[model samples]
Target: MELHIVIEGKKDLGGQLYRQLSDSIRSGRLADGQQLPPSRLLAEQLGLSRKTVSNVYTRLTQERLVLGQVGKGSFVSAPAEAKPRRQLAINLASAAIVAKWDSMHTPLRAPFPEERSRYEFVGGCVTPALFPIDEWRRCMLHGLRQDVKGSGMYRQAEGIAELRAAIAHHAAFARGVVCTANNVVVTNGAQQALDLLGRVLLEPGCVVAVEEPGYPAARMLFASQGARVVGIGIDQEGMLVEQIPQGTRLIYTTPAHQFPLGMQMSVARREALLARALAIGAIIIEDDYDSEFRYDGRPTDSLQSMDRHGVVAFVGSFSKVMLPELRLGYAVLPEAILNAALTVKHLNDWHTATASQHALAKFIADGYLSRHIRRCGATYATRRERLQTLFADVLSPWFELVPASAGFHLAALCKKPLDLDLLLRLARRADVGLHPLSNFYASTPPRAGLFLGYGGIETLDIEIALLRVRDILLQME
Candidate 1:
């Protein structure tokens, strides 16, 4: 049966509908799993339109107040009772969220690659399908059962000690970088690590050397911190260390699997970079973003392992290895910088989510993380091979594509300048998510080339996305 409650004016559109439905659920006017009236039916009761009712229901669903099953209907949720006591209804359509919008990577629209659907080539992604969700669920269940005791207390500022130890051990064994728990600081993501390091190290007008066409986030973080981010040109080998600006306090590079371009820095270049950093008294922020997924060659030794004068701060994350949503990353710091970073860490979000850190520790210690990386490297390589084969067999004869040497994507170097506005429009019309190379640069206006990411996509689906991509670009020709 349809539930009825009359709502008065325009003000009644939002909260009043929420109140009525919530009160119905809580007061037992609606029982658990009781299906809601269709939006059309609910609108008739309130003398309003369906959208207004749908909006309220949408907000309710977002708040965990009600659950919706598309083919069936919305149901009064038992969990809905938690939010009325825990969170307030917020109208975000009107309020501007004050995130210092980190223009660090490609300007990605929120909800970019919508919820693991087919035909989206969303870049810089890891598959949740491959995640240890069952293990995570078990850990959370166990945490709540025994360790949810600290209900209101803030988690440790240094992160979970066990997790920090696990991370330190993993680094020592996997990457050959030596670090103790004090040297490892868990962050929201690798971006947060960048932000935290930027905040502590960069001063107004300070110079930080960065690679041209580098990871956009590294460039953006240094720039946003009021640092003079000098873009040093890179070659097939790596960043030109000799070109590093004088008096620069830091140099940021993705030496292993350099973003978009996918070339690893050579040992000679690494030595020269370290030499230049030592000469200039500069620190190197090594963004080893996709170092784990090397398809072609041996993984380069990390700069941190080689630092004797403490010139490199290695920043890496499980977000790429795991899924991006987990918000797990770490920065290994030199002793001098460690205390300063910890202070900033305490001032910032205080700590990583305790349960996530704990869960990750358990995952790592039990060998799930390492196990996944091996599988991921093999899996992503297969998808990459298929995409590359499609490009080679089908598209590359006509289009100039840089065979993705490593990482999640392959880049198509356009013969002429691309009108990004029109390209994005075509991609949208075709329902594909790809990145533009220009979005990751320091200054020049956005230009040509598209990044075709294959991580979330299957090897089988690459042919279609590539075909559609070829069709879109061919229109310009």
Candidate 2:
């Protein structure tokens, strides 16, 4: 690499070279073991004598900042203890808005490297063993070919035409969502869809209602946008529509299957939520995440399907069914919010990745998505059954399983008060990962319960993991 050195009126050329080289070395700009430009070449570039450059190298060598080799050029020496680079001092006055962001909590996060257990019952995670790798690889190849022949311009913010159409058709067929390509907006993930909707619909201090003991990420997201987020308590039906504040501009619900506590919202409550939204002129953001893996009962209509007055913005994600790393999801927006949402999406990230969109479009178009879902569903169903049996037979004394028709996870409310923290610790010690229901609640006092997700853990491993949990509870008793 060419070295940069300045000479002022040809005065103290060696000293100038030494200072700059020393600073670069000390600051880690010239990384350890990196070869410096030869003295002759550097002297020619800087319009200085080779003797001056060599003297500077010699000085650096004496300081132990440079290593001289017999045949090769000088290189930076590795220090025994690498010095940390100096950081700029923060001197500006703190902003109130930034302080608010700092105070916000992130409830849903991946465990650290050390925190990972052998049998993880973590929610929102999928089994890697069940993914259709061969089928997906073929689809990805098709996406690559399409990308190669593309216009090389930024695609539409609403999404590639094929994906939007595919999503519309899939949503209609599977979840009973009524929409066309024009209504769909493909996003990075369901999270981005929520963010775009929040940007379009929510103003600072606007009232937004989410379910108590609900998806914490959604609650924190709306709060980050300066919206006044309120937690409406949930029962067997879902979010209590009667308790929704009068001034609420937005109401977010996972009606297909409630988050953390898995329960499909009843038809009566769905109609009531729609009526409430219509009466208050509030928009409902129905997050239909992980609804494709329903194991029992007849399929129910989504909130978008039940919507009459264009009040629901139906959001869905492929993360639960497919790989979460895909970061692919879509929102079927009502006509009122569609254009504004598209515009916001354009401003957000230009658009979701085109290659993945093309791959998913092909995945759905060729029926691979449906086939994959069926295959994974069977595995998840078996796991869920194992968990149900364990809870019913071995662990019945400590917990009562919440009846849920869909989704990969189950919620078990405690029979009586117990040390949840201690149970989690003991489970971790036994190489089992356990999650509590307390993390989901916002305003209400959290009930003592556990969320046992069957998606990540193996079918056989679920029994062993729960058995260990039961043993821990026995010890506590």
Candidate 3:
């Protein structure tokens, strides 16, 4: 292959080539045993004399960056250790930042397996083909026109007024959340809403209760703020409210659909959860993430709707319903928490992008958002049914399907314990993606199961992916 090296305006052509080639080898851009271009060919390409190129090759050979054979051309040698650019005044080994960070350790988590896997069952992702590209483009153009004509002023830190009004309207009609535009605070995503809550509500050593086998991102967000996050176990009804410890400062729950394990929080349990938060004076964060798409049963009201006292802050996202890249979600706060959360949000990022906010506002007002959800929901329902049927028919011997009525994924509890390590290895061999249910737990022991997400996976490809999964299961047994 021809190496692209420039020898421009340099008096010492041989020295320049030698330095560049040496840097390439030391950086491992040129792998060991990889053949280099012939000296004459490289000389012509770089507009340098052949003799100059030969001298550079000789210099590289002396530095052990390349090997020369009599008949064969030069080849790259093992990478040499790079020299330090400058002398260090302070050693990292003795720095205070290093010692402080050494005491703090964060768990390593993988990105969505779908990024690399062909037949991905990864959760929390939407199919790009389903996005309303043309409509969104028009809305974006409208936003650009508005920006051009409007006065150049810093917009509201809470959010642009139009987008907040649209979100408030959507929440009131769609999810049974009782709120007005004044009560909403726009955030980058639901994750940022959690961070804002943690900032305003949680102090060091504060106790935070969350559903066990819950959204790991929320748990980590709270933990990063130095709050002691205690995991509360859940039954079919939802989080065991009676078991919640007293003196808790904040509580986080996915009431609409308990994440990973999909089940709605029963009405009685919802009332009990509200009562518990009221009694302890703890703030509640209701993540109504995927509540927009329900397939079965009558819809349940949000915990925020039942609060007579200002105890619940409702957070919703367009990541699951619309597109993850939108980076838009809003929190409907009780009168008491709204101002504090807004301040923290301003401190966080000085509000989310205004242009997307304008675009989304138009999308919602023109009813495009509603239409998109309806279209995507119908497609997702069929995929969900196909997966459930596959689990019931072929995989029933080793798995028990969890009752999931909404959202893009399902969980299957193991019938009998199987070596998860061996099963994962077999799955890798079969080229199927699988995530264990155990990874979601923070305190309680994890149950053996799999979380199969269909958002990114195609409807036609579902059967074929499961067939491979079934084969792997049988081979593991």
Candidate 4:
């Protein structure tokens, strides 16, 4: 066999070797029938110690992965030709319970990028550089230092009292939302918040009004509950409220800047939606997901703030303000539905993690959160401007740049019919990431658009990326 590979020893020696060998197997670089070189000779050739090679081979062989013969040399074992060749698959047939629905098992959790970058413009992530990491870390350490003996104990079902109060105060002040700590419930993230809300609000066969192209997590939750999810079209002004059904339990919306198709709901449409919801006794989920990054002169007051009747559940998150991994988001419920939701929250994970909640509360209360957002918002503003400048110069005249009055991402409407998945693959080969517009839809996919998040990309790099995208689009056209 022939080999062509280079290994870098940056951090951990064992981990580097493990990753290199793991990748070789996964990518089929070392084929099923391939043979490894003798440990001493291979170690000499690769500038590695013979002990290291012997250890690697011994560990792999002890696991029954490779075959070793006394007279004959060791050889790579061929993986069984089954759908999934892992040990679990071999024992699955002998298991106690019947797994009738086995075809759709997902092998992993949420999709993660194959590579890491300081400038990942992921669909929904903030650049860590913008987060007050030092300040937040110090607060976390301090909180732990000052923590009581019961700090590791289960928290109150209502959530960490300080966090709820801080979230309530910040929401009322910044998003024009009105709620008290009693009305607020901390969640793992906006995703879990949606799932919990769906459990409380939706019946198995209930009718729900969802935006045609909306948040994927919400859509999945609604569908999983067997709710009839109806798609409402969006224009420049946001979700057209006219298509909604009367007496519906929920009307999900990202009012500030709609996801994928970034456009704020017009004042008229906002009024119309609230009036309709009030008339039908339906509650509106006012998803103000990314209102903090409003690029326009003045941010509009939220729909929940304007609710005279209790029709809006305002959801806010620190995920946008901080990091995605820190699952901190809150739902400001009206008193009418507060007790019901809290009861469900109490049962569902008992309560949020106390330490994280305490640390986050201090992060916000100490004014670090606001400062980080202000600094990052300005940085994103420059990046957005650079993207706009590049698009104007190179993108086809027919391509439309939809109004993204607020948020890190905006939609780029394509004039031609193109496969978003195929285009995304091509862009990845060019060392770029894209958020396809189709992935947002429940049904009735949009013709073509790209959800370009200008999250943490350096302004200089964005210009070059946009140029590459422009060139790619032109060739595709």
Which pairs clash in the backbone of model 4? none
Q: Write the per-residue lDDT of candidate 1 for residues 1-477, one digit (tens) a residue.
A: 556776776775767888887776666667778788888887887688889889989977887768999798898786534323345777666344234453234454346335433577767776778777787787667555535766668877778788899999988876778789888899998999999889888899999888887776678668778899888887878999888888999889988777766677888899889999999988899887777777776666888887889888999888789888887899999887888898899999888888777778888888888888888889898888787677676676444676445677767666665676786677767876666777666654433777777778876777787788778877877
Candidate 3 lDDT over 60-144, as tens digits, reads 8897888999899899996656443455676666587556556653322446545456777778889988989999999999988
Model 3 pairs whose backbones collide: none
How do the predictions measure up, each by TM-score? 0.75, 0.90, 0.81, 0.77
The model with the greatest TM-score is 2
Worst 10 residues of 3 by lDDT: 104-113
How would you order the candidates by TM-score, starting with the best?
2, 3, 4, 1
431-451 per-residue lDDT for model 2 (tens digits): 999889998988989999988
Location of the lowest summed lDDT over 10 successive residues in candidate 1:
96-105
* Predicted structure 4, TM vs. truth: 0.77
* Candidate no. 1 TM-score: 0.75
For residues 37-108, what per-residue lDDT tens digits would candidate 4 score against the true structure? 777777777677788777777766775455676666566664453132244346566454344233323311
Overall local distance difference test of candidate 2: 0.90
RMSD of each: 9.5, 3.1, 7.3, 10.9
